[model samples]
Target: MNKSSLKVVAIGGGTGLSTMLRGIKKYTSDITAIVTVSDNGGGSGILREEMNMVPPGDIRNCLVALANTEPIMKQLLQYRFKEGTLKGQNFGNLFLAALADLSGNFEKAVQVTSNVLAITGKVLPVTLENVQLYATFEDDTCVEGETQIVDYSKAHHKMITNIRLEPRNPKPAEAVIEAIEEAEMILLGPGSLYTSIVPNLLIDEVAQAIRTSRAQKIYIANMMSQPGETTGFTVENHIEELEKYIGVGTIDTVIVNNENIPEEYLKKYMEDGAHMLSFDAQHPIWKLIKRIEAPLVRINHEKEYIRHNQEKLAEYIFDDF
Candidate 1:
């Protein structure tokens, strides 16, 4: 197959999905990012409460990643205000809110934004309902709202045992199932295990479509454990957690990072109680699925951060595909 023309559907939200989109867009214009909208935190929550629209933060990130615009335009989209009542709010989220008002709906605003930016492919919210995310800790204590879940988990040092969407089984967004049906490849995540990735699957129709699609389903492992959310989780632990919702035998492959992180950066992550997610060769999941481990880490000295090497990661994914 001509990989450049391959139809790809990527699932998840937050920086990871967009980060993957950055690399995948470099290879294929036929990309569709299915982002989560259950975010009730940060600038997104405030805007969502005020605007009564789907949170635009994740959607905006995906649009910027796939955008074919100038660097300045991208910067403008990502720029956040430092002062005023709107301090801490993202310009892109506000842009979407304004577009929502003009377009009469959040979905239409996303579509219009895509056209204006001339972005590659499409970005679809998994569901249209104003969903709430809830997580039950291993101690069986539960918390409502994405923000509270993270804050309480960190404050108490509790592991999340379960997470579900309020008003479960909300309808999937239009064309979402169609995109999955038409896709040649479907990528699950490299994002926050509980909030970014799982909520999408809670929508019955979307998860069902993914299960029945002919597309090769790949779950990209996060570069490291989410410090508070998925602390101490291994690659297999993530897969098992995912299977709790999607069922077994759904994932055909798992792609993980095997590269060594620089000690200085590793120490920084360690300070935050996060660690690189490594694999156990003897894990039984290996018997049922294909595993690809490669050097996928890239250091950003300017930002003093480490992230997936987008181009390298996409090359490896397509190579496996």
Candidate 2:
């Protein structure tokens, strides 16, 4: 098989998907990012609440990641407005919002924007509907909205039973389904387990399509658990929950961090109530899966530790696929 002809579909939201997309673009131009749209926080939340539109932050990030424009254009799009009423504003978000208004469809807006920017690969939303994410804790308590669920679950220290999308039975975008069918490999997350990966799975058709697809499915585990959402989560626990929600044996491989954390950074993370995820090699769950070590994990200038080197990580995934 010609490696360059490989078709890949990456699913998730936030910086994780963007980072993965950046790396994957190096190997194949035939890539599609099926992003989550359930975000209800920060700039995205404000826009979704006010305009009754799907959150644009994740979409914006994916766009910038896959953009094939000059370096200056990439930098410009990522620039945030830091003054006046626009403080903390993302320029790309505003551009996407305008495109949505002009095209009369969010998906179309993304396509037009990508065409204009000459993005490297396609970026798609799992669903175009304005959907909210809700969580039901193991204690039988329910919290609505992604941001609220994050806050309330943390404050109360509860186990999340499951997460669901609002508006009930949303139809996954046709483009997303098509992408799944065409993909040579499908990747699920290095993002928020609940808010990102699960939101995409909550859409029944999307989940079913993923379960049935012929593509090699890989789960890239998050390096660290999110505070309220996945606290104390082990690598096995993450995969187990995903299997429970989607389907058993849906994932063919698991990529995990093998790099050790520095004591200084580990101490700071401990202070912040977070810790690096552990991969116990002898664990029963580990026995049943294919594990790959990602050894270049480090803190970037952003002050947060990311999974590993992007291009090198992509090389690992590509080799497996």
Candidate 3:
């Protein structure tokens, strides 16, 4: 069978989802990336309030990952203004914003951008409705907006107890449901658990579609915990949280990173209260679902960063499961 003929629907936001898309696109061209739009921080946030449009940062990264454009074009898309009021703003995001304005519709702008880039697959925001992300910490104090959730949790040193989309039930894009139904395999995560992954599932229609789809549901576990969001999380804790949103048995497999991090490298993350995900094989969750443990981390010495080894991850997702 032509590998590119396989249908895949990846749901999440941030670099995690975009990084995975980079590798997964090598395996299949029929991918539908359902990205989160609740980010209310940094460049995306600034544009969201000012433009009255879905934040374009996450969407731009996904589009770039799947793009078959020239290296110069890629560089151009990633360029950031070093000074002036746009100091931290990403050019790709601004480009997307301009497209959205010209088209008078965000999705249409993305579609036009996709065509211009000659991307391998489609990208869809999880929802079209204007929505805000809200979170209540274990202390019962709630905050609105995605960035506020992190900042509040950090300031008060509290674990998040729950999160939901503002306005309750934001309707997902029509393509979201169609992609889920056509998907041969549906993948979630590899992003921030609450703000990135869960926010997408918070859409009632999107969650229900995943629950009812016949596709195999898999989760790509994060390599390290987020400082404020998942300070002490273990692999099981992550899965438990996911189950709360999507229901037990909705996830059939989890891809955990068992690769050891160098103590020197681990020190940097540890300083920020993040560490490699700890997993217990004896846990009962294993009896209910399969776990694929491998060296998923790909380190960049020059850049001093770590990301999933895209090719290896994609290979395992196909060969193992």
Candidate 4:
């Protein structure tokens, strides 16, 4: 089959999902983003609280990433309001909220929004129902919600024991299942390990589908450890944690950053309890690692902090896949 005919299903949320989608969409039109819906912060949080809807921030990010619009249009979609009363409101998030309201269905809202924006590929919520994430620490302490779990982990400096979706069971969207079954490749994160990647696995059907599918599964590890969530974690620990949630030998390959980060930034991250993801040649999983000397080590636009360079990232993801 030709490259464009290769279907792909990417799972995760936050900037990682968007970053991978921006890259993969360039290779194939058959892209489906199965995003996490556990966010309870920012504009998506406000809308979720008021309307009792699934958090829209992650979904909004995926929409913009897959959008086929010009650079200016992408900028506009990502533009945030910085004024009294409506400060830090993202245009794309609000637009998605409004569409959800109008359609009276979150899934339909995503479909309508993607079509209206002329996005290059399909974007989907990992689950359609309003759901919350809960985590149990290695100490057996329990925490509810993604935000709370991070706060608990930060204060305790413990690894997460397990995570599950509230309500325990949810019907996976038929489209999501179809995409997974039909995909030639499935990409997991470079996102928050506990908050983004693990939550997707918490769903029984989603996990089962992934296990049964024949797609080549690749995990793109994050360059920097997240504070509280993955403090002092190595590239091996990242893979180990993924296995804890998704089962062993689930990842066929891993892509890690090989570039060196500056000491100044490293100090700042360390203060936040973050660590650089170390790739050790002696490690058992080292043979599966594909190191990309990515300049993802630097800041972007002074405000966005760090981001993967789109053009270079796109080329590499396809090259490896």
Candidate 5:
């Protein structure tokens, strides 16, 4: 397929989806990001409570990632207030909130903001309904809200047994379904397994559409395990959990980082109960899915974190897969 003609649909939330977009946009403008709207923390939670709208933080990040606007404009949107009543709130989230109010809909607001930023691709929320993410721990205790669940899991050392939306079986946005149907490739993950990725699949129609779509489904494995989310998770473990929600054989390919991270950075991450996810060639799941291992890792010395090398990752997808 011609690189420019490839229609890619990425699903997930937080920095992972956005980071992937920054690279993918260089090859094709036909991109659609289906973001998770179940965030209930920080600036997003505050905006959701006050404005009675879907969380815009993830949407804002995706827009900025795919944006072709000037550097100053991008910085302006990402700027966060350090003091006053708006302290810790991002300007982009506020901009989306204001646009939602002006347009009388959150999706329309995203479209308007995308146009304003001259974003290469579109970003759509998985569902339009105001939904709450709930998790049931292994201890039989149930928690409401994304932030609370993570905090409880970390503090109590309990694994999440099940996760679902409050208004269960939410109907996905029509645009999200359309995008999945038309996509030539569908990518998931490199984000929080439960909160950022699984929540989107919990939407019945969205999962159904994904399962039935003709696109090549790919799951980008996380470089490092999340503290409370995927602690001690292996590459196959991640795939198993994903299939438990989306159904068996739903994923066609799995991308994992083979490059080793330095001991110093690994030590820092280990202190926080995180570890690099290892890939086992003999894992049974390999029989059902294709594994693409490469040097997809990049370490940020200043921030002291590990992430996928965007350009290398995009190139791998375009040229290899």
Candidate 6:
């Protein structure tokens, strides 16, 4: 299919989803990102508590990613205040918050922001209901908030056993379901396994839509294991954990990074309690899904961080899948 005709739906939140969108938008304008709204941390959590609205942080990131506006406009939205009452708050979050108030709905605010940004594609919240993420540790202790879940896991060294939305079964957004139905390709992850990716699956109809969609379902595996979440998780481990919620065989393809990082950078990540995801040839998940392994990694010299090369990632998806 041609780029303009391909309807692609990407699911997940945070930098990973936005990062992927930057590349995907280069190939197709018919993109829809279904972002998780379960965040309860930082400026987002504060805004949610005070404004009684869904967190806008992730939505803001997605907006900037697909934006075709000037660099100044992008910088303006992303600029965070250094001091004052707005300290630690991002301009984009405030912009979204203001729009939510003016529009009388958070989702509408998102739509308005999308128009203002001149983004290439649409961004849809997974659910409209105000929901929080919760998790139960392997030891059976429960954590109430997304930020707390990460902190507790890291501090206690307990792996998460179960995760779910607080409101249980929030009605999935109509736009989200419709987007999935019309999509030619559906992508998941390259984000936090618990906080970013799985939370979307926890939504009843969202997961159901994915399962029933005729689109080719692809999952971009994280390059590095998250310290507090997937400490020692491998590519297969990530898929297996996801399958627990979405069911086996729902995902048709797995794209993983087989590139090696320099020892210096690897040491830095290891010292921070993270590691490269191991690629196992005999993983049981292989029976259920196709694996596409490649040297998809790109290290940022300035920040000393590693992420999937956006152009390469987009090209691979367009050419191979």
Best by TM-score: 5
Quantify all predictions' global Cα lDDT against the true fold. Answer: 0.90, 0.84, 0.89, 0.80, 0.90, 0.89
What does candidate 4 score in Cα RMSD to the true structure?
Answer: 2.2
- How do all the candidates rank in terms of lDDT, highest first? 5, 1, 6, 3, 2, 4
lDDT of 3 at 29: 88
Candidate closer to the true structure by TM-score (higher is better), 1 or 4: 1
What is the per-residue lDDT of model 2 for residues 1-321, given as tens digits with 9 covering 90 to 100? 776768999999988889888898988889899999988888878778887888999988899889888898888878888898988878877788888888888888888889977987788889888888889997898888988987875677677987888898698886889899878899998888898888999888888888999999999988887776677889999999998766988888999988887777677766656678887888877666788887747577467554557787798899886
**What is candidate 1's CA lDDT for residue 73?**
85
TM-score of each: 0.97, 0.95, 0.97, 0.91, 0.98, 0.97
Question: Could you give candidate 1's per-residue lDDT for residues 37-132 as a string of tens digits?
Answer: 998999999988988889999999999999998888889889999999989999999999998899788889999889978999999998888899
Error of 4 at 22 (Å): 1.7
Q: Candidate 4's residue-wise lDDT over 149-257, tens digit each?
A: 8888888888776788887878876588888888888888879998999888888888877877888888888888887678778888988888766667777777777
Deviating ranges (above 4 Å) for candidate 3? none
Q: Which scores higher on lDDT, 1 or 3?
A: 1
Q: List the residue pairs that clash in candidate 5.
A: none
Per-residue lDDT over 124-143 for candidate 3, one digit per residue giving the tens place of the 0 to 100 score? 99987779999988888889
Clashes of 3: 0
Q: Is candidate 2 or candidate 6 better by TM-score?
A: 6
lDDT at position 291, candidate 2: 89
Q: Which pairs clash inside model 3?
A: none
Candidates 4 and 6: which is better by lDDT?
6
Error of 2 at 203 (Å): 0.6
